[model samples]
Target: MSAVLAQAPAAEAVEDLAASLQEAGTVAAPPEDADAAIEEIGLREKESDQVIDKSDKKDPLYAISITSFEDPALELGELILKGLYEMKFSRPSKIQAASLPKIKMGRNLLAQAHNGTGKTCCFVLGMLRIVTPDTTPQALCICPTRELAKQIEEEVLKMGKYLILHKGIKVKCILRDERWERGERITEQIVIGTPGKIVSLLNMKVLDGGSIRMFVLDEADEMLNLGGLGDQSKRIRQRLRKDVQTLFFSATYTDAVKRLATQLSMDNPWSQIEVKREHIFNDQVAQYFYRTNGVTEKLERLTEILSVVNVGQCIIFVHLRDTVEQLANTLTANGHPVSPLHGRMEAGARDKVLVDFRNGTTRFLVTTNVLSRGIDVPAVTLVINYDMPVRKGGTADPDTYLHRVGRTGRFGRKGSALNMIHDEKEMVVLKQIEAYFDRQGLIKEIPPDTDGEEFEKILNVQ
Candidate 1:
C-alpha cells in the first residue's frame, strides 16, 4: 500500500465539521464583559462586507453584498445549496460574505482573512459551482502540508456530498506517497494536494491541467515563503492554463507575500479582501503567559496545568523535533496521555496521529510547526507554546505565533493560549510578538506560584 493512504470520512462524520462551521457562524457581536485583550484585538469590522475588484468594468461585482448563505448572488446549485444548509451554515461569515461573490464571478482572488473565517467554503463552493461534476479534475487546491490537504479534501467532500451522490462529483487528496502508475490520469473533479505531489503529477502527465478552471492556494503565505514550496507551486501553475482563476487565502501576509501573490495572478485583474491587524486575533480565545524559573519549572508548570484545567484537547508546540519527543516521553512517564508528531515521521504514522487527535482518542499532542496551519480540530481548547516560535536567527516570528494560538478558539468556540516564559530571553520574544500585533500588555502574566484553582480562574477553562 502507498504510504499516503487514501481514506474518506463517513457520512456520519460529515456533521462534525458542518456543526463546527455552524458554531463558528458569521461575524459575532462583541461580548459585553470584554477585557483589554478583547477590546484591543477585536475590532468591529466595517469593511468585511465589501470586495475590491481591480478589474475594469462598468457593472463590477465588487458591490455584490451577500449577507445570507442562500443569497442568489452566489448562484449555488440546488443540491450544493441544500448540502450547505444541511451542514448547518445559516449565514455567511465576514470573509465568506465578502469573497464568495468574487469567486462566483470567476475572478482571481487575493484574500487575507483571519482564522476560522470560513475561507475554505469560499473556494470550495466556487469550485463546486464551476466544476462540471464529470470527474475530470476541473478544480485544484494546493496546501502547504499533507495534513492540511487531507483536511481540505474532507471539507470538499462534506460540502459537496449531495453533488457527490447524484452528480458523481469526486475529490482526491494528493500526497507524497501517492502511487500513480505509468500514464495513469487523475479522475477527481476537484483535487487537493501538497505542492510537491501536484508538481510530480504534472511532470508525469498524470494530472492533465488543461481542463482545470480554478487553482486555490490554502495557507498561501506559507506556500510562498517556505523554502522550495514557492518554486514547486509556481511549477504547478505553469502546467495550468494562463486563464485559471487563482485564489490565494491565508490568515496573515507579509508585503513580500503580497508581491508574490500578485505575480502568481499573472498580473491579471484580481479582487482582494484584507482584515486589519487589530482584528486579526480571535476574541474568544483568552491569551495568557506563565513565568517559570527554568526548563524544570516549565515542565512542572505544564504538568500542573494539565492536572488543573479541563482541557478538551490541547496542543503543545515546541521549537524543535527533539523537544517534541522529549516532552512527549516526559509527559507520558508522568502519567499523561500524549502523542508526538513531526516532519520526520513516516506518512502512515503521521496520519494515524492526526486521525486519533481529530477523533478525540488523543487529548494531548506534542508537535513542531508542522500542524500549525490549516489543520482544524474543533475540540482543541488549549494551545501551549512550550517554546515560543522564532525565525531561523532567533527573531520572534509573529506569523507563526498567530497560527499557533489559532489552533484553539476555532471558529467562535471559546479557548485559551498559554505561553510559558522561563527566562528574560523568552520574555523578549513574547514582547516582540505583542509589539508585532500592537497588543502591548494584552497577554496577561500568571505568576508561577498560582494554585490550581487560581489557574483555572485565570484561564476560565470549561
Candidate 2:
C-alpha cells in the first residue's frame, strides 16, 4: 500500500506536467499572419478591418467603465427605471455597466465577470428591452444549473413585477422535467431554463427559436464544462435566425471557454473585462486551514470547532455523495441540525434542502460540488471543506475550490472557510490552490485536539 501510495503522486505529477506542456506548446505557437491568411482565403482588407473593429469592440472586456451606472441620463424605459429604483439599485455593478449598453443595442456579447457582481441583472435588463408583452419567447436564458436558472427567473420576476402588473408580460421558468407540449405554443415572452431542458424543448419543436431574438448563456464556463456546449447550444443556435443576438457570461475565462465563445460567435469581437485580482476573493472571508493527522482526527477537530464557533449558517463540503449523506447523518445524530445536498437527490428534495438552509431551518448543509456554483445562500457564515477535493478528471479545478469557499463571506459580510486536510497529498493540493491565489499565509497547522478558546484565537473569531 505504501509503495502504491508513493507511485500515485508521481503518476499524478507526470500527468499534470504533460497537460501543462501541451497547453504551453499551444500558447507558444505564433499567431497566423492575418493579411496572408485573409488573402489566401479570398477576403478583403476592408472586410477584415470590419471584423477587426468588431473584435476590438467585443474583446470580452473593452469599454467596461469602472463607473457602473454613473450617468443618471443612461437611456432606460420609465418602468425599468422605476423597477431599478424600487429595488434600491442606484448604481450598476461592473458587469452591468460594461455589458448593458451593448446588450441593449441587440449586439452579441461575450462577458466574463466574477460571481455576485450582478451579471444576472445585466442580461435581465437586456432581455427586458427587446421583449414586448405580445412577443412569444423573444428571449431565452440558459444557465448551467437548475438552481441558478431558478434564481435568475425569480430575480427577473422581482425586477419586472411592476411590468407584469401593468403590462401583463409573463415570464416563465422551464425546468428540465417540465416541457411545453408539442403544438402548444409558448405564451411567455421570456424563458429561462437549463441547457438540457431547453434543448429538449427545441428538439421537440415546442420552442420556436426563430422568434428568439436574444439568447444568454449564464455561467458560460460551467455550461462548457458540463459537456452541454456542442449539442444543446449548437442546436439551439442552428434553430435561431442568423441575426439573433447572443450573450455569454462567466466568472472565469478558461481557454476552453474562450475557444467556445470564438466558435459560437463566428469569431466575432469579444470583450474580456477582468476585475482586479485583489477583488476576486472576498477579503471579508477569514480563510484558514487546519491540518490533522487522519479523517477521524479531522472530524474530531471539526466538532470541536463547531462547538466553539457561533455559526449562523454553514456549508460543509465533501467530495462524494455518500460522504455528504454520511456526514449529514453523523452530525444530525450528534445533535447538529444538518441536511444533505447532492446530484443524486431528487430536484425537489435538493431545492427543499436549499430552502431550509436559506430559511434558517437547517443551519448546516452537507453537500458535494453540486452547490458550489451559483447557489447563493448569503447568510451562510462558514464553509467547511471536510475532505480535500480530488483534482483528477477535471472534477476539482481552482475555480471549483474558490466557488466552494465563496459560498460564505458574500456581499461584504464577514465569513470563514475552514479547510480540513489530513495528509501530505491533501496539503500539497492546498498549497497549489494557495499559490493560485497568491495567498501563502492562509494555511496554518493546528495542534491535535485544539481547545475551543485556542481554535477561536487561531481563526480570529470575535
Best lDDT among the predictions, by candidate number: 1
Candidate 2 lDDT by residue in tens digits, 269-362 = 3344455433466565777778887889787777767778777788999989999888888888877878999988898998888888888898
Clashing pairs in 1: none
lDDT by residue (1-462, candidate 1, tens digit) is: 111101122333333433333444333322333233222332223334333443334334443446556554455868887777555565566677667766765568888877776788788898888777565788899988899998888888888999999988888888999789868989988999999889888888899887788899999999888469988988888898887889999989898988888888886557777877767887778899999889998999899889889888999999999999999999999989899999999999999999999999999999999999978888898999999999988889999999999898774567899999889989999999999989898798887679998888888767
**Local accuracy by lDDT, each model:** 0.79, 0.68
- Model 2 TM-score, 2 decimals: 0.82
Q: What is the lDDT of residue 250 in candidate 2?
A: 68
How well does candidate 1 score on lDDT at residue 26?
A: 38
Q: What lDDT does model 1 reach? A: 0.79
